[model samples]
Target: MWWDIVKVLYIATRWPWPVEMGRQRMIVQTLEFAATLGEVHLLSFGDPPTKPAPDFISSSGMLEMSGLMGIAGSMLRRPLLPLQSHLFLNGPATAAVMEAAERIRPDVIVFDMARLSHLALAIHRHYPGIRLVLDMDDRLSKRYQRMLTNETAGDLGGTFEARLPGAIRFLVPRLKKLLLRVEKSLMDRSERRAADVFDAILMVSALEADEMRTDCPGRADVVAFPPLINELPVPQQDFSRSVRFVFIGNAGYAPNAEALELLDRAAVQVSKNTGSSDTDYCFQAAGKPLAHAVYKKVEVAGFVPDLSAFLAGNAVLVAPILQGTGIKTKIIDALEHSVPVITTPVGAEGLGLTEGEHFICVLGEDDLAQACLHIIRSPEARGGLARMAAAARNKGLTSQNRTILRDRLTFAFGL
Candidate 1:
């Protein structure tokens, strides 16, 4: 049978709308690709994020998201399972999945992230003939370890916080450091389990994919895929439109929150180091505002509706991420808009970007301040970095690279 004849079932932990995080963007991008190959049946948790469900989705169903109490009870009942798995896949979710599979009669089942790997396993157990594809996204275990090493694990806030029990919510801020220690172990175990079961595992980061191949129980091949980017920003010629240094990310995310703090201090350092007035050094943030995050220098722009325009007006993206894993999508967003970036080595990881060419990699607030001064004072440097980064980004996001992932998905569906 032709690849287009293959029906694909995607069990999304959440609808990839209100896309505040990179993982959510991953879900939408993967699903869009799946839709291009064939009909995609989506069974997502909670309500549809947007109205007039996307045209790529052939059909859709909403599964009830587990409440905090129910998830806690599930964790209590199933001690062996990762606590996060209760919040993701459970007995009811498995049942719902089976019912959807029966109706769709899909040949392939696809899901993203380690938390939903339990669903992949459950579906495979029930229907051994259906091939499973895991879009594992990032190496969460490594990210957790990075946070632990940097002592920023407590910043692990997410959209789910609002739903957490009052006591747990109150305690989580203080307890996150300990919970991350436990979660790192769980995520490692989950990655191994998924690697052992799934037929195809897709990772956005080539570096992480290689690491996974070395460490995990590999029954199936683990492939690294370039991040899917369908939206191309209008090309900009000018790199010195303004002196603004921007950071784009969701504050609900831990690494973003961590970066926000670093940027706040970096902004102040730049002012003091260069004796630059507000006109010479403007630090701006665009995305979900971090609550109670007192920033002495950076101005929170909240979610900018026109990111392309905003990035065009701002000359540089300063993402001094403390620690985390996975390709920084915001850097990609910045480059696409022809905006140069100044980020930590951690922020630049897995993107195959080069320092002093594609982006300026800095280590601390002092270095960040120096980089800002260098860029703002040198128009040649600003223009050169943005041009090089834009060219590099185009090469990275080429269809040739995406075709590897597309072929992998098709082969898995046929299997």
Candidate 2:
């Protein structure tokens, strides 16, 4: 059969709208791209707008399950499932998925995240020979595992100790450890099941894909495709006064939250070392509210509608991501926007971005501060970094790279 004749159905746990997060944007981009190749249908749990698109099917809002009832049902039916899975694998969501699959009769079913991978078995049973593809973009299990390891190692920098009151800090670590342990156990089982069920498991990072493959020895082949950017912005030309650093992400997210804490610490040290007042340095945060503790130094620009425009206006994109799994999409976004970046080596993982060439890599708060100051002081350095980053983005991640990713997706499912 020709690839164009393949019917693809995408099932998502949440609505892929507004394109705020990396995973969400990936889902949206895939759907849009896939529609061009074949007949595509989207079924998701998030509430749809009043006038939803023809191709988009949303779960009926008929019965809003009571919180207690939902919890009780989850606990009874799926004792070992993670809380997220329990919330998603409900009656309404299942019904919606089945209805869409039946109506579409898709040859290929794409689960946007591991959360929806449980549906693969049921869909395959009903459809007999459907190709199941699991796009594990977020890598929830690996992210949580890293967090667990960090917590266990007593490296809880941006955890309960910082968030909660000192009075309860003693108990917070123990409670957190218990919760993470249980969640990790459940996720391990769930991820393994996902690997066993899906024909192809798509990951954003090669390291994560390898880890998944190791966990489920002879299951599906895990494929790694770095974060895809459909378009690239023209490189920023002007590098002017006032050293400005911008960080973009949902600040509520654990990894981003921790990274923000690091940024805050770095900002303080930078200011103190340079004898620069708050006015001399600007830490603009986009996508979510800045932390209250760093409110004085950081300016909160909640959810900028135009991310590219935001990056264009800023001097450098600072990504001090301490811990997370999978590729950092914001870093790619910055490079694509032609804005030089300052990120920890952890942030640059899996992107094939060189430290000195593409962006400056700094380790501790002190190093990060010095890096920022150096970039601010040196126009030649700033220009060179931006040029290198822009060139890399153009060569590595734009529409040209989409062909490679699209080919991989198609080949994986025998489209």
Residue-by-residue lDDT tens digits, candidate 1, 283-315: 899998877887998899999998888887546
TM per prediction: 0.91, 0.85
In model 1, what is the error at residue 165, expressed in angstroms?
A: 3.4
Which ranges of candidate 1 are over 4 A from the true structure?
Answer: 47-52, 229-234, 239-241, 276-279, 398-405, 411-415
Residue 287 Cα positional deviation in candidate 1, in Å, after optimal superposition? 1.2
**Candidate 1 whole-model C-alpha lDDT, 0 to 1:** 0.76
Judge candidate 1 at residue 251 and give its lDDT. Answer: 84
Question: Which 10-residue span in candidate 2 carries the lowest summed lDDT?
Answer: 57-66
Q: What is the Å distance of residue 152 in model 1 from its true position?
A: 2.8
